[model samples]
Target: MRTLTSSTTRRRLAPLLVTFSACAVLSGAMTPAAFADDARSHEWYLDAMQADSMWKVSSGQGVTVAVVDSGVDPSAPELQGQLVPGEDLNDGKAGETEDRTGHGTEMAALIAGTGAGGGIQGLAPRAKILPLRYNVKAPSMDTAPRGIRYAVDHGARIINMSFGIELPGEIPGLREAIDYADRKGVLMFASSGNAGDKDNVITAPASMAGVVAVGAVDKSLTVTKWSNHGSELALAAPGDDIPMRCANGEGYCSSGGTSQATALASASAALVWSAHPGWTGNQVLRALIETAGRPTEGKVPSEYVGYGFVRPRMVLLEHQGDPGAANVYPLPNGPASASSSPAPSKAGQAVSSAPQHGEAEAAAGSGNTTLWVLLGLGAAVVVGGVAAFVVRRRSA
Candidate 1:
C-alpha cells in the first residue's frame, strides 16, 4: 500500500513553477540587476560563497543538471550552449528548450547562466542545464515518474527540483524513480520549502531517503525564518533576496527565492563533481556534506541547515572532506554523532541561537531527529493525483 500524505511535490512547484498557483512568500524587493554588466556586483552571495577562488579549481565544465521545474528558454543569451534537449511534461512550446513561467529560466541561470548579455552569472558558468518541463495541472501519477525517468535516462548527472507538493499521499513510483536515479549515480536536490517559522514540515522528494533536502539562508549565514526545517534537511544555501531573471525569462529580479537556493546547491555539487570527475554521486555528496561549514562537530545534521552552509571552496581548495563508502547512504539510521555547538560567526554562517526544530545541543550525541506525520486536509481532499501546494499555506 502507498503512504498518503502531503509534502511529496517539489518545493517551488506549488508556488513558482505551476501556472495559476497561489503564493504567499513575502516578496522582499531589491534592486534588480538590469543587465549582466549592472549585475556582477549585485550577486553579493557569490563573493560570500567565494565563487572566484573555487572557479580557479573547477568551473564545472562537463556536468549537466536536469532542471525539473517549469520549461526553460535555452536560447537565453546567458544560456546559449549550456542547455541541452530535455522533456516536456506539460506545455509543448517549452519542451526542454524554452521557459514559460521564468522560474525555470532563473533556476537555469543560477545553475549555469553565463555572464552574457549582461545577465545574472551562474555558480558553474561552464556547466550545462537540461530542461525538464512539467505542468502543475498534470496528473501526479503521470508527472513524477515520467519526468524523473526521462532525466535519468538522459545523461543528467545532477537533478534540481526546487518545487514540491504537500499532500497526504505517497507515490511509490516517484520513490522508485528517485531510487533509480541514485542507483544510476545521480545526485538530486530539492527545496525544503519556505515555511520554517510556522509549520516547519518535511517536504518531498527532499524528505525521501537518498535525495538531498536543501533549506535557505542569507549571506549572513543566519537561517531564515521562512525556510522549512526538519530532519529531511541535508544542507542550506543562500535563498533570501537573491538577484536573477524574472519569470518571463526576459527581465531581472533582485529578490530571488528558495528555488534559487536549490539551484545554487545543485551547482555546488556540479563544481565538486567537475573538479573530481572520477568520483561517484555518493562521493561528491559526501564531500559537500562533510566539508560544509557547521558549528556542531561529528555526524549529526542540523534540523535547520543540515550539515550547515555549503562551502564548495572548502572542498575544492582545502580538500578537507572525505568521500565515504562509494555506494553507502550517509544519513544515520539511528542518531548521528554530535558535539557542542559553536558560537555564531562575524562573516558567513555560525550556529543559530536556538536549535533547529528537532536538533539538540552541540554536546556529543545530544540531538534527536523527528519525523512528523501528515494530517488530513478539510473538504478538498486531494484524491487521484497530487498537486503542488503553495509555500504560504498553513500546512504542507
Candidate 2:
C-alpha cells in the first residue's frame, strides 16, 4: 500500500488555470549539474522510510518490474547496470530505452537505481528494471492498444503505469488488454493522476479494477493537497519535495506527484515479494494494506488517501502477515464496491492445470516482469485464477 500527500479541504483555483499549483511540491525542472551531485546523499525519504533497516532484510533482488511510461534512459550513470532489455509499446521496437521527458528515468531510479553517478538511489537497488515505453498521452493523434497488450504479452511481472487519461466509457481494446494482463498473473500499479486541484476527478487505468492506485504524501507524513481523491485510491507514498535527477539527463532536482509515489509503491511490493517467493500477489497486497500508515482515525477510508500512507518497511521487517487466500483479490472493483478486505488467494495453485501456451505466450510477450505477463488476466478474477467473466478480445 503506497500513499502521498493532500489537503482535507478543497481550494478554489482561478478559472482558466494554466497549471494547477500544488502545496509544498517541487517544480518539474532539472538542472545540468544537479545530476552530478551525490544521489544517495539527497535521498531524505530513506530515513523516514527506514530503508536502511529494511535493506538488511531484503534488497528486492530477483524481482523484475516493468516501467510503462515515456521511456527510460539506459545510459544514466546510476541506471547503467540495472536495466534489462524491454519493448517499446509505441512503435513495437526494442530500442525505446531512451528517456524523452526524464520522468520515466526518475521513476526507474526510484525503483531500482544503484545511485552510482550521484543520481538518486532507489529503494530496491538490487532489483531488475524492465522499461516498457508507451505514449498514452502523446501529442500525436495515432492510437494503438498493442503497446499495453504487447507488454502484457511479454514477460513483465509487475507493471507500473505512471501515465493516464480521463476518457469516458471503457475502450474495448484497452479493457481487453487489461483483462489479458490480469489473467496472466501480473500485479499492475498506476498513478492516481494529478487532477485533484481541478475537476477533482481520478484518471482511468488508476480507476480501473486490478490496478493498485497510488497517491502522494509529504515529509510531514500528511497527504499533499494536489493529489486527486476518490474511491479509486488504494494507498499512498512519499511524493512531495522529493529529489530526482534532472529531466534533461542533467543533475538533481525535486518534484512531487502520485507518479513518483507509484514507483515507490512498486519498489515496496518488490521488497515484499522478493523475500516471500511462494506468497501469491494477493498475500503480498494483503500485507501492504494491513500494515499501511493511518494519518486519520476511523476504519472508513478517506476519498484522498484510501486506506492510508504506505509503509513498506512494516511489511518487510515484520514477520507477522497473513497472506489470506491465494486466488482472491482483497480489493473489490466497480464504483459501488470500492474498498477491499482480506481474502484467500487462488492465483498460482492452478498454473499446472491451465492451458499454458497462448495465454503463456501473451504473458511472455509482455516484458521483463514475467509475472506481469504471466498472471495478470488470471489475477483479475475472484481468486487469482482465470475469471469466468473474462473474454478474449484481440486488438488491431
Candidate 3:
C-alpha cells in the first residue's frame, strides 16, 4: 500500500512549518499528533489528509514498499528499524540503503516515517520500506531497471520510484520489469517529471501502461503550473511546499516535485490495502479513483489532475467500494476471468477491511465510473525475458 501527494511550484523554497494538531485545528476533528516534538515537522499534507484519524483504523501495518531511488538512509530518526535489507543495483555499491545525495531518505520518510523525535511524518507510518538504491544523480549511466526487477522478485508489495528519466524510447528490459511487477500484483507508482511547466513530458515508468502516473498540485488544490498534463496520467496529490529531511539529514525544509507526490500516493495506497486485507490491487486502485475530490462541474479529471486528488478515506469509509468483478483482472492486457461464475464463497457477500466512516465521508467524484484505468488490470498472460542493453546515456 502506497500512494502519492500533490504540490505546486513556487519561485523560492518555502520554510517548513510544523503541522502539529492540524486536523483538530483545521477540521475541528480530533486527531493524534504524528510528530509532537519541535525539531522534525512533516509536510502539511499529512495533517490535511487526516492521517492521524486514518491511522487509528489502519497505519499501513501490513504493507511493504520497495523504494527505487538514489538510496535510502536507514538511520534517519523516522526510519529507524523500518528499512529491510536490500541490494544495490548501481554495481558501484552493495548496500542499497546507503543514500549518497539524501533524496531517497526524504522519499522514505514521506512514505513510512515513524515520526521519531519530531522527524518528518509519513503518510503510512506503519508501512515497511525496502530500500533499493539506483543512480539518479549526476554522472550516472546505470541501468536502474535491473533494480526494479529485483525489487519485484523480492517480497515488496509495492514499488516507489521517485526519479524520472526522459529516455528517447522505452527500454525493453525496463518494460519487462514493469510488466512483471504488474503481473506479480505489485503496484508501481512513479513521478511524472519536475520539468512540468516546460516540456511536461511523460517520463519512464510513469508514462508506461499499467503504471500509476502521479502529478503534483498545491494546497489550493490547483494543478501546479509545472505539472505535466496529458494521457498516461492517473491521479494527483500534494506535491508542492512538502516538508522533507534535508540533504544533510540534520533538519527539514520545504521541497516540491512529483517525487514527493509519488511517495505520498504510495503511502495512501498502503493504508487502503492494510485496511482491506481481502481486496486486490485493482480494487484498491479503483477505490482511489472512485473517492478522489473534484470541482463543481462534476469533477474534471483532467490530464493535469487525472481522476482528481487522491483521497483514500472515501474508500476506507465504504463497506463496499466497488471491488468490481473479482475474477476479472483490472488491467487491459492482463488476464480475464477464466470462469465468469460468481466467485464461490461461504456467503454471497464481499468482504473489505476498509475503516468505517461516520455519516460524513470524503468527497468522491460524481462520475458513475468509479475506477480509473486506460490500461488492462488482468494478470499478465505473457512473460518473457527482455534483451539486455548497454546504458547508452545517463543523467543525474
After superposition, the stretches of candidate 1 with alpha carbons farther than 4 Å from their true spots are 1-37, 91-94, 137-139, 247-251, 297-299, 333-396
lDDT at position 240, candidate 3:
63
lDDT against the true structure, each candidate: 0.64, 0.61, 0.62
lDDT of 2 by residue, 213-326 (tens): 887765444455567778878887777656665444444454677888888889888888888878776678777766564322223244666665566766776564566766
Candidate with more favorable, higher TM-score: 1 or 3 = 1
Which stretches of model 2 miss by more than 4 angstroms? 1-37, 92-94, 136-145, 334-396
Provide the lowest-lDDT 10-residue window in model 2.
Answer: 387-396
Q: Compute the lDDT of residue 230 as modeled in candidate 1.
A: 77
Count of backbone clashes, every candidate in sequence: 31, 69, 40
Could you tell me which 10 consecutive residues in candidate 1 have the lowest summed lDDT? 371-380
Q: TM-score, each model?
A: 0.75, 0.74, 0.74
lDDT of 3 by residue, 13-80 (tens): 22333333312211223333344324334455765576766787888898988888878887788999
Candidate with top lDDT is 1
